[model samples]
Target chain A: MSDVKKFMYVNRKAPYGTIYALESLEVVLISAAFDQDVSLAFVDDGVYQIMKGTKTDGIGMKNFSPVYNALGDYDITKLYVEQESLDERGLTLDDLMDIKYEDEDDDWAEKPSIKVVSRKEMADVMDQQDVLMSF
Target chain B: MKLSVLVNEGPYQHQASDSALLFTKAALEKGHEIFRVFFYHDGVNNGTRFTVPPQDDRNLQESWTALQAEHELDLVVCIAAAQRRGILDENEAERQGKDGNNIAPGFRISGLGQLVEAGIESDRLVVFGD
Candidate 1:
């Protein structure tokens, strides 16, 4: 059916500086409610959004980094983090927040949602999406 | 082919609206059907009827209105974003007790579901933003 479209959300900006990150999350949440096949890619500065120790208290903003932890509740578990972006920023996978979900089909085994991919590999994922929304 | 276009930025301040317009016009010229054009975030500002740009420059709102007139394009402004940005329709203005409504012709305020529906109904969903 044309209604079950594969949606890919591309996030290329850092969070907090602008509203793109928050607005994008809102769209993703809305897309999830539609039960569409959705995937998210964090490229460039977008990777910074998921990094650990993201304190927004000084900015008088809520710490939104923890929201990534709740994405699995919406069945949104495909989060691709570009490896090149992390390397350029001198960040390692450990620097990111651990986002995992329990797979009920697999005896409730915990599974990590974030996938580290190369720039080229991320391009392949983008190609497979029927609808791509950027933020 | 049925296409869905999403504009994520305001007009003039960014190249998004201009590019979206060009792309929509080209797609229409090529005989492609537009399922809908969703305006989200700051993009909702593009649906205001009260913009008064200089006479020398082309008015983006008028351009969009003319295109919608010619093509019957479905222009949907996200209600949440429109309300936040003060781009209210008559119903919304009355509900909010505002002085007036400023929603441009050919644009209707709706929910975020319209954006998702466009992706499902359209063959391609193109996003224009900064």
Candidate 2:
């Protein structure tokens, strides 16, 4: 019931090997703290951000992917995955974590009460939000 | 309307900076006011004056400098991030006993408050990152 606006975070980089994912996550958390309606879309290498079972200890980096699961507690549950990106990377819904999915065919269908989706569908959803931030 | 832009990736490392520049220009062209640009993490490198790209390249640092000059944009680099990366202004370089300053003009070293203020002041906050 908060009057806060809506925001869409477009993530396009891999979770690790760079600071983009970490910084983007921080921004999302901060935006959520303001009571904004927050959503996230993963495209390109960014899909790796929500992949299951990651271990970064060998690289002296902590595995932060687990923190993503806690986003729902902040009311940031809208997570999407680009269909083409998944197909190109040979990934399936099973390869990702538990979230909603938005396929191209479901554009006009009721948003599945879930969190996965395709890039084209994500663009449409982004247009509905007050702000679209890409990372 | 006022817009706050967040640039989180270094210039040329990805298309983030270019995209941000384009967005800023487009927003201005539409008669919008830019509240501020908060450069964080690796994005602080965009303000480094010592960077020189190859002769055949488009000098991104110079491009940013030009944008700042032309638009009088508020370019803010995070103090913590810049210090960790060895980018310092005249006062910071002198305080840290560095040989000279590496950060260019028109960019100020600031804290996270600038980002918060920008968010509060702008009607829209657009982030361009890696």
Poorest stretch of ten by lDDT in candidate 2 chain B: B112-121
Off by over 4 Å in 2: A1-3, A98-114, A118-120, B11-31, B52-72, B79-84, B88-102, B110-130
DockQ of each: 0.69, 0.26
For model 2, residues A41-122, the per-residue Cα lDDT tens digits are: 8888988888887888889987888678777566666787788888899998788866433334656343332355666787
- The segments of candidate 1 whose C-alpha lies over 4 angstroms from its true place after superposition are A1-3
Q: lDDT at B74 for candidate 1?
A: 96
In terms of lDDT, the poorest run of 10 residues in model 2 chain A is A108-117
Per-residue lDDT tens digits of candidate 1, residues A44-77?
9999889888877789987778778988888899
Give candidate 2's error at residue A92 in angstroms. 3.6
The number of clashing residue pairs in each candidate reads 0, 8
